[model samples]
Target chain A: MKKFLNDPVNFVDEMLEGIYAAHPMVTYVNDDLRCLVTAKPKAGKVGLTTGGGSGHLPTFLGFVGDGMLDGAAVGGVFQSPSAEQMYQVTKAVDQGVGVLYIYGNYSGDIINFDMAAELADLDGIAVKQVVGNDDVASSIVGEEHKRRGVAGIFFIYKAAGAAAAEGLSLDEVARIADKARMKTRTMGVALSSCVVPEIGHATFSIGEDEMEIGMGIHGEPGISRKKLGAADAVVDEMMERIFNETDYKSGDDVAVLINGLGGTPLEELYILFRRVRQLLDARGVNLKHVWIGEFATSMEMAGASISILHLDEELDRLMAAPANTPFFKHVTG
Target chain B: MKKFLNDPVNFVDEMLEGIYAAHPMVTYVNDDLRCLVTAKPKAGKVGLTTGGGSGHLPTFLGFVGDGMLDGAAVGGVFQSPSAEQMYQVTKAVDQGVGVLYIYGNYSGDIINFDMAAELADLDGIAVKQVVGNDDVASSIVGEEHKRRGVAGIFFIYKAAGAAAAEGLSLDEVARIADKARMKTRTMGVALSSCVVPEIGHATFSIGEDEMEIGMGIHGEPGISRKKLGAADAVVDEMMERIFNETDYKSGDDVAVLINGLGGTPLEELYILFRRVRQLLDARGVNLKHVWIGEFATSMEMAGASISILHLDEELDRLMAAPANTPFFKHVTG
Candidate 1:
């Protein structure tokens, strides 16, 4: 595997160190650097805490800041962090309005966050949660809850962060987050597998002329594997899959995020976005806002994902709110 | 080569089309979409225009916007735009205050831009220019002008963009850009080669376990090709080379950009950033500001570059000035 690292085992912590060193406003909530919390905490506002594995920059930890998530419990590359770490973050950011756990729908994260919620309950801190299951490729219609979360977590974070910043109650904030998760859909394709440092090899392999459509970020199986197609055909398939799984139709307004899975050039992303825009217009969908970049990544994997958020009144308003995260410095609605 | 594209020849144009569709604030200055200019131009403010090859996004076209650049002339992948296209941009952006052409240093770009400047002179638009040559490994200190411009152009862009925004004259804006370029130094390492779409193969290649230190953005040979080392050691050598090429002393303040080449993970960029931070701090170099991300790329090549901009007071203020570009949304000094 080709990559850069010191010790494979220290990959996660070193990355966190680099992040902590670069962002002056970021600090660990406790002795563990993985338990990251913003130095600026709004006491009266509903605090949001997310926990997930590393490898996805700006997904969980990168979103921890003003107008976004307040704290995050980070794990190793595609590995789960401990429940104690999540509880530490929950405790640190719980500024009396209670804490809301908004994270991916993964068993590791769910168990750890639920345990953290129990620990918070013992401390008389109310906790609510919204699990993101927006990857349409992972499950069929009416089985969205069984689907995995992907880059679409960005929408949920932005919407829920804005709701919490408005001083919403914990339940209201969680409701908003849950609603955002329900409205978002993502589909990805993998051209190359990302090399995890500790593993020192690709998590999986594909033929030179092959690609896996609807592949999960962590190399999970996809709905289809075939000869790599053109950018237009690939984007068409992705958007078609997303539309089939949703109630998106003519005259619907939506926001779009074209996420690069680490290795794709930004140029290709815009190319993908161009076709998506054309497809949406052809189908009478009104594309309102667009964010094109590496919002979520899979550690140098050569691929990309398209996330469509069917925006409603609340999501439209909240998406427009300003967020000052280290990663999405200009990701306003 | 594994990539997403319809036809190799249509790559650059399709990418530009995607950019045009995604950013409504952006438009072609002429019939040719390669000559792009911002819709919002500040009358009486010195206009800044740049042009270069296609693969390096944000390096040229992505930097065109308010507080960054007024216009940009794009070209085919790793190929220079025509002089006429650059002249189109220069004329469109020059709202009677003159135009400053800031771009990377390369034979093709230099020759074309010089031709464009001569044409602008004929039009009496008062054209000035600043050529970026900050890649320390491309040339020695005594012959710095022979170096290649890499990620360090971001500093020049930020500084000159701010200067132009402040209503500086063309000459004054060029001065600031030149000063920024002079104070900046950069070094890069490539773990893998980038594939040009039309070429349909790698521009160059290295061993699976070997890396070339100081590789140019377009796969120019570096000073050394050896087995890949740990992140810390590679970063240390890069920093050591940069320090050797400049007179960066203790107590001096600086800004940093840890740029990821196309295929390197953001995590690795941070790992590199962490070492740079420690190296500077230990040398009594006052690290005041930092911008870390894929500021520049080499078309999915696995590598990164570190740019160090020694900041003076004016440079510091200008770097902090607000820039609303499609890329670098939060990159204030």
Candidate 2:
């Protein structure tokens, strides 16, 4: 494999060490390398935390800073962090207020975070969670709760973090987070697969002229493989799936995120966004905000995902609130 | 070539249209799609403008915002913009305090920007220019002026933009920008070649087991092609060359930027940064700041570059000054 790495087994630890060295705002919790917390925690506010595998950057770690996440429990690439690591990060960021765990809806993450919350409860710390379930391709209708989370988790983090920063209680914060998750939807298409460092090979492969529609972040089997089509056609297919899955309609306010799957360049992401905007305008969807970049990604996977969040008044206010993080920063109302 | 694009000929215009649509802070100058300017300009300050080819996302267009470049003239993918585009951007951004043109040192860009300056002069708008030459592999020691510009252009942009935001005169801003350029040095290694959309093929090719050190952004030949080595060894060779070509001393304070060439993962970039920090620490160099991401990039090239800038007090202050752009946002100092 052509990669800049020392040893495959030590990639995660060394990467975390490098991140700690590069960002002053990020620090280890209780000397545990897997648990990264903000250097300065805001007191009397609900502590927001998230964690997942290492490949998707600007997801858990990059969101740890003022107005976003308080702590993050990072795992090895494509693996889950231990319950012990999550407990420690919870303890590190919790002030007088409680801690809430937010992460993608994966079996390993759900199990570990539930164990950590149980452990934290014994230590006299209140804990709650809202698992993200935004991927429409993972399940059929009436099975949205069983769907996997994808790039739409970013919207949940922003809205829930804004609510927490407003000094909401842990229960209220969890409610807002769940509401956001219920409204968000995402779908992705991949032209290539990503290689995990330890594996030293691509997780999967596809024909050069074919593309996988509705693929999950971890190379999960998608709807089908088909001959590669034009950008607009692919976008139209993805958008139709999303619209059918969600209750969004004309004259509704929404937020849009065009996320790149690591290997795609910004030029292509923007090109994809152009078609997305054109479709939304024709449908009379009022776009409140648009974000186009690599917000979450599989390591060096060539693909893109579209996420749309139907915003209510409360969700709109929370989404528009100020946020300052290493990867995301906005000073909108 | 596997890419998400429509007609390759219309890629640049579509990408720019998407960027304009995504960023509310940006708008076209006089309905000209080639010239992108900030919606809100700070008057009586030196108007900072930078432009280049379309592939580098955050370089020329993403930096047009508060406390950064006032405007950007965009070109086709991997192609220099025209003099007419630069002249229009110059006219649009020029307040009473004149305009400063900052871009990479390339033959087409130099000729076009020079022509734009002449055109602006006839229109009674003062224009001064500073070209960046920081790539250590493009030229020998005495021919530093002939070196190609690379990721180190970001440092020049930050320093010069901060100086211009401080209301410095045209000459003062140019001087600071030039000083920053002189103190900066960069070297890169490419694992794979980028594909130009119009050509629908790789710009160049290399053996799977080989890497080109000190390669130009557009696939210009590098210093050597050798079997790919460990991250530490590659970094050591790059650092040794940079140290030998410059006058950086043991007690120097510097800012380091580890920039990805579009396709490398952040995990690998951090792995590379870990080795870079170790080398600088052993040399007694104090790192004041570290930036690790895709600051400047070829379309989807698989590689990375390291840039180091030895800073004096003025340059340090300028580098730390607050700036808010679409891709970069820091509230330091």
Candidate 3:
């Protein structure tokens, strides 16, 4: 593939520089650290931060704004940002209000962010952390809490940001973030693998006519391998697993997210949503809201995920709260 | 190429349904009209709105949030949303603070948006419209005012939204938006054409060894065709034109945007930015900010665009103001 770069190693740094240049309202620490902080840190409002490997545009960084994250640390393509980098972002965005750190459930991310939280506490900056493990496909039937977090991270960010905006304490933010995670569940499938710039090749190879179910965002091994199927069938498989994993009964209100894994077109996402609508309706579940697009992505991988957040009246109110960020936004009803 | 839709024509409606399903805080009029309005219409602040076609996910809708756009009229893929749709969004979001109609310079968008403005006036709602004609590519010498707007529309949205969020009046917001457009310029190149869902094929064709300059977002013809060159050379060519078009003086402040046309990666964008930085530094221009991503895309077309906005103190202040949206957010410094 034709590409632009002098050295593969410099790709992430250069992109960060470009981002910092275009958005003066956004600041960064160690260029090598890949830690980005918002220009405005709301004093007295709990700070929320997230970081992960790069490549998913607008997920971590894009969520930093008036009612979203306070800072973000971006790692190299598909690699978790370093612990030190997360620590710096945590420090930068800290404004007397304690900080809440949320990120995906990847092993590296968990270790690094956990380390960063500890480091923040040492700085006299109170910090709490929440890991988003919402992927139903990555968990055993009985170990649902260990699932990998996918695009459903947006829900956590929204709920946490709104809580912070409402002057919730750090512990309160973390508590609500955990609640959001509990309400969220995700499942993804991949039809193709992405070519990492530094790696210079596909992370995993798949036959043209094959698809992998429960594929983790960072190209982690999925639960099942099968031939490519229609969009509805794919949606059914993902929704079934996600529904089975999450506890929801008829008449329950839920938020549905049909997220593209970077390469899938809106056309296909819609096709998948059609089936999702049918199945949810049939189950007597009230689909209160929906979002479809490339939210969290795995570079140029072609696939989709279905995420459902079973909502209570409180969760519904929080979800309806106005949110603004680079990659997602909403105004309450 | 593998795709997700059973039928091509169902792209927009299906996508809209998915959006509503996922985001409970947003609503649509005509439900099938593709115009998205925030559920909370009266935020006690002036409402900002934008409209465009589908290919640019997050551009129109992504900008809707706190300190950004209040609503968006999304059209068919790469097609202008109708005037009636724009009118509907305006009516929905007008909280008596008046409404600002911001859009690109396409003839269709202009005509339709104007119709919407007139329709709003008939309903006793104050409305002001500003067109983003920021592309330095499509105009002749001394005719930059006629340039077609490209990705620079985002800058206009940010600046104008900031002003409105600060309680600027309708006319004041319009002026700032116009000022932003005056300082912005964009130029795009296409490495490959995007396959339209309805067509199931590329709207245009280029050879494996070739690319085109000054291409429109919707696979329209470009100003020039040439063999694909190195990433630096390609950026240098784009910069040379954009630099000369802006007449940016030494030590002048400007915001630079290196945007992917949808399919390019960060590796390539950064590679191009590496050269962009060198060229600007050599010219003594102070780079105030940079946004590198698929902020404005044309489906999965593999190409990139460069946008430069000469910043004055006022424009800079507005640019630095906080903004929150789905695809982008600006925090005050």
TM-score of chain B of each: 0.98, 0.98, 0.95
Cα lDDT of model 2 by residue, A23-81, tens digit: 87889977788899988788898899899999898777889887789999999998899
What candidate 2 gets wrong by more than 4 Å, as runs, is none
Report the lDDT tens digits of candidate 3 across residue range A169-264. Answer: 888889899999888888888888876767877889898779999988889899999887766677877887777656678999998788877766
Q: Which numbered prediction scores highest in DockQ against the true structure?
A: 2
Of 2 and 3, the candidate ranking higher by lDDT: 2
Q: A37, model 3: CA deviation in Å? A: 5.7
Candidate 1: tens digits of C-alpha lDDT, residues B123-220: 99998889999999998778988999899999999999999888887888988999999999999999999999999898897999999999999999
Least accurate 10 contiguous residues by lDDT in model 2 chain A: A324-333
Ranking the candidates on DockQ from highest down gives 2, 1, 3
Candidate 1 residue spans exceeding 4 A from truth = A331-333, B331-333
lDDT of 2 at B179: 94
- Give lDDT tens digits, candidate 1, residues A1-333: 677789999999999999999997779978999999988888798989888999988777998877789999999999878999999999999899899888898999999999999999999999998899988889988877899988999999999999999999988888889889989999999998988888898899899999999899899999999999999999999988988877878999899999999999998998899999999899998888789998888998889999999999899888888788889865442
Error of 1 at A65 (Å): 1.8
**Model 2 TM-score, all chains together:** 0.98
TM-score of 1: 0.98
What are the lDDT figures for the candidates, one per model? Answer: 0.89, 0.89, 0.79
DockQ (C-alpha) of model 2? 0.77
